[model samples]
Target chain A: MQDQPLHEPQFALHVEDLTVTYGAQPALWDIDLDIPPGVMAAVVGPNGSGKSTLLKSVLGLIRPVAGHVRIFGRPIAQGRGRVGYVPQRSAVDWDFPTTVLDVVTMGLYARIGWLRRPGRAHRDQAMAALAELGMQDFADRQISQLSGGQQQRVFIARALVQQADLYLLDEPLAAVDATTERIIMDLLKRLRDQGRTIVVVHHDLTTVRRYFDWMVMLNVRIIGQGPVAQVFTAENLRAAYGGQLALIEGGAVDPADPHP
Target chain B: MTAVLEALGLLFQPGIVQTVVLGAALLGGLAGALGAFAVLRQQSLLGDALSHATLPGVCLGFLVAGSRDLGAILLGAFLAGGLAALSIMLITRATRLKTDAALGIVLSVFFAAGVVLLTVAQGQPGAAQAGLSTFLFGQAAAILRTDLWIMSGVAALAAGTLAALWKEVKLVTFDPDYARALGLPVLLIEGVVTLLIALAIVVGLQLAGVILMVALLIAPAAAARQWVRSLGAMVWLSAGLGAAAGITGALISATGRGLSTGPVVVLVASALVLASMLLAPERGLIWRWGRAARARRGIAGRRVLAAFHGLAEAHDDPAYPTEEGMLTTLIGRPGPGVMERLERDGMIRRVDHPPETTRHWELTERGHDRAKRDQGGRP
Candidate 1:
């Protein structure tokens, strides 16, 4: 193991003037963002808010229209085997009759390259991953038998098996039980402690303050992004979550004070 | 029958038997393995289309060389079958038409064109022209030693490729999205799986014929799926089943004169599928019936326990004593036979001290745990 590399104290992933378009409609407009290493940062927004698109651009799954995304000073492709991705749970059809262990082992496919079978070492690595998520009991159970939370955990385990320096998880907590949510949050904290950067697409606003240390408040564009306490305030909340802004902003008032 | 047996005995000489068995087995195994992915991915119909599409290429090959060289015919078949697969892919991707409809459209049109080509080829003066119709019914007896060698070599090559890419194939077929997210070349992997299917169908066309080759690809795989859960297991099972079908078809056709080997082989494969459907452990009819019977027994056991639970909750004093009517109410169906059955099972006992015509029921120790687990209240 080597010492973690550093670009700056407050930046791990850097996106410069990123823009993407689907045909004529711009899915993402000019956007610039930075996320430092070892922090659980979130890209929070509503539907079609470019939250997923941003992650895809970073992963190089979709080519950006106009900018570069660098992982620790190198392009994403050069960072292969160092970045892990967990796509949305709904993005895949679940009725294909594969077990949890079978799916988790897919993480090794890229590492092994084409035309080679996963050897004994790969199976051992996969089992370690399953045990990490406490899913060893269901390892042989078909993926379709899993609840939403278990499926999400299986995806996380797959990412864990990748052993990447940075993890990009999309809506991992969505539709999960509270215990599963806690487990994921704890796993993210552990990953961060190990000096890995984790970028998550989060949905639950209530738990966001407690769960994340940094935030990329987005609504088709960045509202504000930095430390959660200072950067995520009433004004930024209003900009990002427009209609519910007052409800959130109104709760910010100190209750003991009589004056506005 | 004796004469047929004697004839088969003559053909069973080591050289001939070894050639036919090894050739058919290799061919069957390759087609079956590739077809597992095709059937799993719901592209079984593509096998049909590609098999028919090889005809024009065969004609083109004959037309080009004016000879029946195996190399020329194989090249032509590969080109035409591959083009057919590519066209199917393009149509589905470029148009709103769904896969099944597009496959149907392609299959009929290409097959009709092949029929027209065959008609035209009948007037052509060539030695190769004699066996063009043989491709339709598959002349197993006419499989020369050279043809066997080519088929065996192609089968080995295809099987090797499949084994090499098995994991990638399974991943993409199971979940293309996850494969894409991991930066696996999904299009390339899919193209490989498709190409393997096309290659299998093309190679099989001369042995199994266009009309029945689709059956060869799908039946063994579909049959194998009924018996296995893992992709590896399914592939192995499919290969075994296919080899068996091929050998049996060849033997029967060789021994019994006037039978077409291709249709016989397909029929053998279909019979395997039907047998698996009826007899497999997980999804078969027998297993399903067994499960249903067990469920009925569980429900009967629960009804007895429900009667006991009713008695335990009956009185205001709640000392757990109740009359006969509670059993009927708790069970949700009024029947004298249910009470009698419950008593016979020793799950509940009829009260003897009550007035002669009426009786009360109470739980045995076994009944308590059964009821608790059912309600999910406790164990």
Candidate 2:
């Protein structure tokens, strides 16, 4: 993989001076980032930070006040089909009368187009995705009947069925059980190994080093972003978290590793 | 019985009765199908506001056309309803006012404007405003053949739209943010849904009137919701229920002396909702009540068995018969007929002691096994 010609390897995501505001208050200030393809990256930050806002901006759910976001070195609209998104679990009404298989089938709606119902092939693809997430048995069950972990897995399965080259998740591990955390982490690693770029809005500082290859510490603006081992340092953590650094400082950082 | 036969005969003969029935049924079905989305999205009141908001548009349409041209009136009503919906969206999005407040504000303001416009139109020197008042309370008997044609066209459009975009609509209603992220043209889908709802309300004005039309939209869907667990089933059931209510109400009203059709139709839909609330399985209030009662009885029976096991273990005799007073004390209530129920259930036995002795209970072997299982085998 390293021997190939490198003419500025196209980044999976490129943000230049992106800014977002809600009303008069700025939710995210000027921010710039470039994430290389095939890396599992984590956007870590304190509460009230623009972690979710950034993801929304990239997905075009929220219009940025100033600047642009490019996916695969092209506009988001041009490459939207290649991008899959897993929004926060809380963003949806779980009580909606839909089955797991029905939700997974929605991933294919963009491909199916208007007036065309999903056929047997779409159903088979959905089932295959559910099987990959170990959720095949739950295909017929209403979404509300599933546990938190199972629901998160269903969301993941929905994204998986998209078969996109780039995946963006917003707080996928929040409120999930340990089993789900493990399942998600393993699946993310596998996707990365298969050359898919995955970016996640992550909160657990302890798992950042172990689960992600790259890190972007943000608090309204980009604080530091690079290889996890280099940019995920005590100084950068302090800069992002302020006085609340103690909560994440203990047991999460390796003091023996020297920082340059 | 003669009156009923007469009414049925009149209904079958192809006149005002047939047109009214067909128009009511079409309106009911469309409202029901669209109302399912409104109910699911928790926008039932939004439907009310939108319906009321269409009044101004109806008056405006009548004024502009100088007559009650069905097409012109409907077009005007659609535009007014659409504006009301847009204003509600804007108020909620651009200000501190919540959705309920926005709905209330828009509903009342638009309705007042409609009333004023209606009065102005009524006073016009040459205007034939005799039937204009029917839009307020909806005189189903006044439906004409042309109106029926309009109703059928709207119904067809609504049904076709639902069929073509069923999946997209469901996704947007359930999770618009996710739909937007998937680049699914979330705004366009939402606009289409709002348009369909406006169309339903406009076609319904002649049959149900604007004031009571929302009941047609909400009641049938809300009733069907009690019986179904899937969106597809809910949509179909809601449509059927709406049609049934419309036909039945229209027929019954036709049989009676000078009764308006709107109230009758709404009453039938309300009856369906009440029946569903009381009788539908799983989520019905009565079913839940019964389940709770059964669960409580099971708990009491288990407590009695546990008391029996405790006494037997203490006395080192499996056949020990504990008095009813002891069992009551363990259960924390007299529970008047619990012992008899347990005995009938074969979980307990009445031991025949001396004639003067108080009745004592002993656990049957089956009862002891159940007690152990219920208590998780804890001593």
Task: Report the Cα lDDT for candidate 1.
Answer: 0.78
Query: What interface RMSD does every candidate have?
Result: 2.2, 1.1
TM-score of each: 0.83, 0.93
- After superposition, the stretches of candidate 1 with alpha carbons farther than 4 Å from their true spots are A1-10, A91-99, A112-121, A140-145, A218-224, A229-260, B1-11, B14-23, B88-109, B126-131, B134-141, B166-187, B252-257, B308-346, B349-362, B368-376
Report clash pairs, candidate 1. A12-A35, A12-A36
Every model's TM-score on chain B: 0.82, 0.95
Q: Write the residue-wise lDDT of candidate 1 on B1-379 in tens digits.
A: 8856764675568665455655566678888888888888778888888898888887777667777767787788889888888888889877778889888888888888878887777668874545888877676655668877777776777777767777887888877856776678889989987887777777777778778888888999999988886888889899999999988776776666677677888888899999999999868999999898766765666766766665675543323545666555666653336556666777666655445466765666555556667788552
Which is the leading candidate under DockQ? 2
C-alpha displacement of A224 in model 2, angstroms? 1.7
True contacts kept of 1: 0.47
Model 2 chain B, poorest ten-residue lDDT window?
Answer: B124-133
